[model samples]
Structure formats: C-alpha cells, structure tokens
Target: MTRRIPIIPTAIVLIAAAIMVRLGFWQLDRLAQKQDMLARFTAAEADRTVHPWPRGGIAPLGYTRLQLECRSAGPAQPEAGRSASGQSGWAQVVQCATPEGAKARIVLGWSSQPAPATWQGGAVTGTFVPKGEDVLVYADPPLAGLQPNARPDPRDIPNNHLAYAVQWFLFAAIAVIIYALALRKRLRG
Candidate 1:
C-alpha cells in the first residue's frame, strides 16, 4: 500500500549533494590559505628591504620595495584608478625597458584627467605589485607633476572564499530539500 522510493533519481541527488558539500569544505581550506598569504604580504610591506628589479616571478615579492632603472619608456597611458587620498582618477602607466632587458609596467602617478603624462625614463623606486601575470611598480612619490597613486595594500585583495563556501553549502541544502518535497508528494499521490 506504499510506493517504493525511486532508486536512480535518489542516487543522483545524493551524489550531487555530496559533491557540493565537499566543494564547500574545499573552499574553506582555500580561505585559510588566502589568510596565510595575506599575512605574509603584510609582513613584506612592513619590511624595508629594497630589491633590484626582478627578472623572475613576482608573487613572492609583492608589497616589497624595489628599485630599477628605466633605460627607455614608452608613452604613458591613463587608466582609471584612485589617488593616494582615495579620490577616483586616472593612473599614468608606462611600459619601460629595464637595464636587464626586461619590460616592466610602472604606475607613475595619478591624475584627475585621463590625459597621459610625459615621462621618458629614469631611476624608479616603488613597491612591487603583482597584477595578474604582469608586474607593476607603484611609484612612492608622485611623478611627472602628477598626484601620488594610492599605495598598494594587501587588504585590497578580495577574500571571498567564505562567501563561496556558504553558497555551496546552501545549494547542497536546497537540493536535498527540493528532492525531499518531490518524493513526499509522489508518495502521497
């Protein structure tokens, strides 16, 4: 006098829920890793060690002070950014050829206008920032008569793993609840 529970559909639902729960735990692990990385970056920022222009990876050196001579520089291009005082504006960036023959992007300064600045090349000292696959040096002092660009802070990097983990957990719960409701209705009918 009772309908048997569906086998294949129930199996699929449980399996999917298990996967989602596992993913949630994985995100939590990632959150811990991100916290550790941010702590290292904060320490690096506080250290006064100045390194020469890096020809290798920049990830481990982010937020550290670096100095490099720009043997030649391309025309400046203005990118939307914020000034040191937190005012939204333009960032004057230039592609420079380093003495070691490596190319580097330098954020010369900030400006209220989108127009680029006129800078050929010179000795540059600033904070090393790893942006995606590229490396950018944020000038410590305003360059080419432009305003200072906002200093790079590790806090600016987003740590959304906790949010992602919560969303995954919610999805798993929702799936199980929806399946339970459907199964209940089928058995009643």
Candidate 2:
C-alpha cells in the first residue's frame, strides 16, 4: 500500500508560507521608503533657510526651521517631556494664533514642574517637529525662562522594518519545515 500526501493540509501550509513571504517582501519595500524619508529629514536639519509657518499641512515641512509671529497665545499646558540636556521634565506648550490666523502649537520650553509658563506671544523661531496630526515648534532659545526642549533629530525615529522582514521570513521557513517533518512522520506511520 502506498501512502499519499494529504492535499488539503499541504495546500493550506503552502498558502500560509506564501503569505508570509509576501509580507516579508512588503516590509523590505517599506524599509527602502523609510530610508529615503530619513535621508530627507537629515538634509532638512542642515538647511538654515527659515520658512514662514505653514498654514495647512506640516508633513512636508518637518525638520525645517520656521519663523512665525504669534499674534496671540492661549494658556500654557505643561506636558511630560525631556529637556535638551536629556533631563526628564515638562514641556510648556501653548496654542497660538499666527498672523495668517492659523493655530500652531509651540513648545515654549521645558520645566521641572508642571506649572504652566506665562507667555503672551511674540515672534518665535524654531524647527518644525511633526507629531501625529499636529506640529510642534521647539523654540531654539526657549521662552518664559524655562529650560530648552530637546531638538528634533531624524535619528530619533526608529526604523525597524529590516528586523520585521527577517522575522516574517523566519516564520515562513519554520512553518514549511514543521509541515514537511509532520508529513514525513505521517507517511512512515
């Protein structure tokens, strides 16, 4: 009597392996894209050209230095943050109305206490750091007698696609090996 391979189980295993392999390739593509983005950010940091505060989206202006006149400012809100010296502290942030009537968040400075800083608003210059849907302007000289907030650096952003790709590929190889071993054992039995 001849033992035949189980068709359904083999097909399922193959499909799963193929999916994993595809996912690995996708991650590789993401890795390339991330590298390109980081390169652009690094170049932006070296650029000293200060641009007017963006009125709309801030994604493309990330890492670029910007100057804006704060027509008016709201109350300051101190959030947990880090100082430029790598010390744990609170970042004094406030919503300010620009000359263009656009709202912008300014990281006035850092403080050891959570007490909000007093800043009426004035001409501010800083680098644009993209955070989620919003952008934060980390004041270069800081404001309200508070400590300096950490400057934005492209290196701070993590690029883990390579590791993710390796994990997916390993999972695919392991799945194939385990299925082959199980099938061989069944045939012998």
Candidate 3:
C-alpha cells in the first residue's frame, strides 16, 4: 500500500526551506560585495600623495595617507594594538592639535611598556584608519622608540557568509528528512 505525505505540513516545510535557501544566497552576495570593497581600499592606500585632513565634521578618507602638523595636546592614552610582526602590545595614543586648531588622535606607536614618554609631535605623516566610529592615524614606521604597527589588513575583516550559507542549507536538508520520516511512520500506522 502506498502512503501520501500530509499536504498542509509538507507545504509549510517546503516553504520554510525555500526561504532558508534564499537567505543563504543573500549572504553569499554580501560576501562578494565586501571583498570588492576591500580591494578598493588596497588600491587607495597605494597612492603616496598626502591628502589634507578633512575640515569641519566630515569623515576622513579611508585607507589614505595624510600629512599634517600637530602638537601634543595633553597626555598619551594607552590602548591595545598589534605590532608589524603581529605581536600584541600596548600602543600610546596622544591627542594632537591640528593646524586648523581641531583635536585628533594619533597612534604614536606600539610598545611593550604602556605610556611611553610623550612623543614630540610636529610634522607627521601616517595612514588614517577607521575603527568603528573613530578614526586614527597609524604612523607607518612609527615615531618614538616603539615598533612599527601592522598595515591595516582588509583580510582581517570578518566574512562569515560561507558558514552562514552552510547552516541554511543544512536546515533545509533536515526539514526534508524529518518530513519524510514522519510520512513513513504515519503510513505504517
């Protein structure tokens, strides 16, 4: 004797599975877009011309180098950062007064010791990096006696889209298997 799957439950499961699959594809698309952005960032960094710091409240250009004269405003704040060699250590960040009389933070360098003597800030050139809502410049070779910090890495940006896609596909497979098993049990009964 042949048995038929329950129409209502089967239809619901199929619909849900399709939605999950679509979500997986969407994540994949996002992954591609993120990769393209990273490539553009790398290209921008390669240009050596120093761009002036943005005036007013405008956001600084990402991955571009800047040349500016600024002096130490107050004291240096210690923060966590990585060295060029990928070693973790404390970095000295000091508030600097821009030529335009605005305050901006400058990452002097990475040191094993926290709060290294205040760096004599003057004519400075560095790459501007954006961490969340805040943007700070990383002195390429670093000033003071600290080690050089690693260049901003696009690869470091998280791309978990592939994992998310796998999860959605797995959910679809499980739904199909469970429905088939339920149908078999009902037929036996």
Candidate number with greatest lDDT: 1
RMSD for each of the candidates: 1.7, 1.8, 3.3
Question: Per-residue alpha-carbon lDDT of model 2 for 1-189, expressed as tens digits?
Answer: 899999999999999999999999999999999999889889999998888775464444578888889999999999999999999989999999887777789999899999899999999898888788776788888988999998879899999999999999999999999999999999999
TM-score of 2: 0.91
Residue lDDT tens for model 3, 25-126: 988888888778778777768887787775565666668888767755457788888888888888778878876776667887888777564776776678
What 10-residue stretch in candidate 1 is worst by lDDT?
Answer: 53-62
Ranked by lDDT, the better of candidates 2 and 3 is 2
Q: Per-residue lDDT for 109 in model 3?
A: 82
| Alpha-carbon deviation at 78 in model 3, angstroms | 2.0
lDDT, residue 42, candidate 2: 90
Reference-based lDDT, each prediction = 0.90, 0.90, 0.78
The candidate 2 region of ten consecutive residues with least summed lDDT is: 53-62
Better of 2 and 3 by TM-score: 2
